[model samples]
Target: MQPEQLMLFEIAPDFRDHKKYRDGIFKTKAQLKEELRQLGRDRIYHVLSFGGGTQSAHLLEQHLQGLIHYDYIIFSDTGAEPQFIHEQVTWWQHRQRACGNTTPFLITHHSSMERGLEEMLMRYIHTDYQRFQMPVYCSTLDPVTGEIKAAGMMPRQCTVDFKIIPVKQAARRAVMELNGLEYRQQMPENIGFIIDIGFSYDEIRRINTSQSPQFKYMRLAYPLAEENLSTADSIRFLEDNGFPTRRSRCYLCPFNCDGARDIGMDWDEIIEAEPLSFLKACWFDTELRRVQRSGSKIMRSIPYLHYSRRPLVEVFAAEYARISAAYRVELAEWVSSWEAAIQEKWNQDELLIRA
Candidate 1:
């Protein structure tokens, strides 16, 4: 890589050992740990623990032990994360305190500059629901075959601007503020900050590509990918460990897919509930909204952004009894395995504790 590219971008291999980089798509626990261990022991760097714990994949309950050595973690809460996430955060707070640290897992990013997902959609896209077409059934025509697969409502945009963009800004501010590092400015050269992200190896391409002068002063470390526990394995690990794994989803996210077996709505409900939301939020031009009245649905039922780890299953059931029962036996078996792992960690890592 040339110096110019290093300043502007840094490209790395997309695949290792002839396999696509393992991101959320696939990975294992033991590999995930090794990734963290290799992340380094630098104190100047900061490891950001992403908040949205969609099935205990968030940094707190999932990767706390792997994160302590770094500096700070800036978590931007959209106030839309799943309910069980709140519980894991509470437990993580206590664990951090016991280990002589004070950072709360919940870094609620509140601001006078608050923007609701709905309101942002209207401001950016400049459209009203009454003016645009809504999908009550299936697609008018299929891409390959002219057949209607399913049907429902269209989606809106309350995620990108309200959550993704804002969080990135907050992360920038957190780096600049640095608790008190700005005033001191006393850190040594070549030992400046590193920003540790939760993205796994599968996401390495994005992490590598998502560079800017702003986020590049700090070197990056990916503990999860380094360890090899990509997204699928992380969920599998949580399920195998005994802790409740599903039903942990955001309250109003636009990216829900696969009719989450445990929590929240599928693409159908999301699109119907907030039509033309993304058309507006995507913001093609400041002067017009008519051209942007696009739909977020795939066929007639699914939201385009709603990707699923498993097959379609009703996500939000006012009554969750049936869904809860589906995973009862499986969840119990998983909990037993985690309990055993936790025990083994305590028994075997005593010397590491002192270090």
Candidate 2:
């Protein structure tokens, strides 16, 4: 074979082997570990943005103070998570202590800076008079045509407005305190910081395209992806460490499709676990549906959540109904109460507007 032909033949097989490049352009674990060792760990301050979810717990159990030393671990609460999640967070705190780490856990919230998800939902429905548009990417089933369709939402600023900004602020504060510097001075120019996010190997696309911290002094790092670890690996690590896994998220977060069933938290399970919180979710859904109906120039055959284009309550109720008769009855009661509560809130809002 010609030299060019031989080179082409050697390269052609790799194109079909998708697994070889599954992690994109990042270095392997060994390469990353060596690079870290070379960087002289003393100079780098690590700040873990702990999500308090399964993936985050896995990351913490595997990395924080165990394999990697971090200066701080921060959790941003939007003031919308269920009590069960908070309990798990408390457990996580104790677990971290037991693991022989004195790194302080910082709990921050957007409520301190701006309105949280609950207030945002209330204003979106009662005051702002804006439509709840569906995310353009996700396809939803059309009741009339019995086909899946896609649309767009206004914009998903919640992550940036609520989670990212608050967490970054908290991180900055933590770093400042650690260095014993006053807030008036600019952050230490010589020091480099790593914002350790917990994206796993399965989410390689995110690892590749995700933006670094906008701040010049900070850089984003995903150790899980660098190590080529997936959710299964995370779960195994948690099990091996004897720590229970729990998903931490806002109760009404629209991103939670199928009611967060991926983390074993379907809508039925949520309602059964926290009936009051479930009612709040239903009420929130009702308001978003109202906004959609009022603002959409086009009529939608199906309803959706504040974020989703699909009907939230209807879809969740359908899933719950399939499980048990008693569950269905409870679901009906919750829906009725949610609707009534929404109506009362709407009336009160209207009265305030007229006044």
> How many residue pairs clash in all the candidates, one count each?
27, 3
Model 1 over residues 154-265: C-alpha lDDT tens digits?
5332333344344445554555465445623543333334444566554554344222233333444455665654566566666675544443334334344433342233
Report every candidate's CA lDDT. 0.40, 0.61
lDDT of model 1 at residue 350? Answer: 27
Candidate 1: Cα lDDT at 84? 49
Model 2 clash tally? 3
So what's the TM-score on candidate 1?
A: 0.47
The regions of model 1 sitting more than 4 angstroms off are: 1-15, 18-43, 54-63, 66-68, 82-88, 98-100, 104-113, 125-191, 201-213, 240-244, 247-249, 252-254, 259-355
Best by lDDT: 2
RMSD after CA superposition, every candidate: 17.6, 7.6
Instruction: List the candidate 2 regions with Cα displacement exceeding 4 Å.
Output: 1-43, 63-65, 111-115, 129-149, 152-157, 180-184, 208-213, 255-263, 296-303, 306-310, 316-355
Using Cα atoms with residue i matched to residue i, what is each candidate's TM-score against the true structure?
0.47, 0.68
